[model samples]
Target: MKQQNNTKTALIYAVDLLAIRPYSTQQLITKLKRKEYAPEEIQEAINRLTARHYLDDTDLCQRQYQAYINEKHRSIKAIKYKLMEKGFSQSDIQNAQEETDIDEIDYEYTVCLRLLNSRYIPSKSDKLKCQGYLYRKGFNYSAIRLAIEDFFYNP
Candidate 1:
């Protein structure tokens, strides 16, 4: 009876957290552990959430991927790291990428262009600085070069 009560409490806490935002299984487990819940209780809560369809890592990955791409405009590498930090496995991340049909080169070019035009204009006489900024944003050398060329030549 005591163990069952603990499990129920843990499940309620987990549900409350999920009501705020989605969490990966690992993330939720970590959070529950930090709350001093027993590992078995945490696992039980997670299992219940999963069984009830209240927790789906794949769906979370897909939603996060779309948000990063469409809203944050993050580079693929950056997004990958973010997903990893959020407790997504490499296989899950890869699956999300495949489902999203992201074209790396095109995405980099577009992001670079947007960054150049909006944040780092070539007309500022800081072409190298602009390149460095894009590099820090996880764009590759080739994509940065092409974006710079496209910006200066076309504009």
Candidate 2:
């Protein structure tokens, strides 16, 4: 009966995820485990979902990347981090990110302006803080430098 219950639970979980939106195999497994599913059950459910076309990693990657692009405030590095956090593999991140064709801008400058406009005038200490924040937000060194330049351009 325990096995049966697990199966039913997995099915319910799958249905819930599908009803909300599509997901990737790894993403679904991670979510199911979060909800206390057994590994075997989660794997079975993931396989079922994949067979039913409710979970396709490629499609999910494209959709997610496109959504971020449409939102327009994200840099590629940040998008890659988001995908990684969502349990995407390196290959998946590379593939999905490549599909994104946004013009690369100075991420630092862009984010710095956002920070400054929000009234975050940076002193030396604040500069360090902002740098850390951008790093955590997944901006590359180049982008972060551009923002710092803007912040320090107070002549």
Candidate 3:
């Protein structure tokens, strides 16, 4: 009876989360585990949700990848890292990634330039600090170097 109660609670928890947003199976499992459900119970809740199509990995990945693209304009490498962090499988990310455009480097570079202009100045002050800021933003070394070089060259 105690076990039955836990299962019901876990199920409720899963339902609430699914109602709010689609979650990868791994994400749901981790969340359920953190809520103190046993591994088996977590698995059961995830299985139930998946069977009902309330938690589709493909759909979740698609939504997340689209958001990432729209918001961050992250590189494939960075985007893959994000999806992995969000508990999506490589194949799932790969499939979703196909829906995105590649060869968008120029657009990203322009966005990077705007970001750098606001955050990083040509001031003799705080070169390291500015570098660190862009690095943290996940701009590749080449992208940063080129953007900064072109920034000054065009000025």
User: How do all models score by TM-score?
Assistant: 0.89, 0.70, 0.77
Enumerate residue pairs that collide in model 2: 108-143, 108-147, 109-147
Best by TM-score: 1
Question: Residue 113 of model 2: what lDDT?
Answer: 56
Q: Candidate 3: give the clashing pairs.
A: none
Off by over 4 Å in 3: 1-7, 73-75, 123-136
Q: Write out the backbone clash pairs for model 1.
A: none
True-vs-predicted CA distance for residue 2, candidate 3, Å: 8.0
6-52: candidate 2 lDDT, tens digit per residue:
44588687789879877667777767777777778777777777788
lDDT of 3 at 94: 92
Compose the digit string of candidate 1's lDDT tens values, residues 1-155.
13343445788999999999889998999888777787787888989999999999998998898888886477889999999999998988998888997677888899989888888555665778888888999987888899989987788
Stretches of candidate 2 exceeding 4 Å from the true structure: 4-9, 33-41, 69-75, 122-129, 152-155
lDDT of 3 by residue, 1-155 (tens): 12444445788988998788777888888877777777777778778888888888888898888887777556546777989998998888999888777545664566567766765556553555655665777777776666776665563
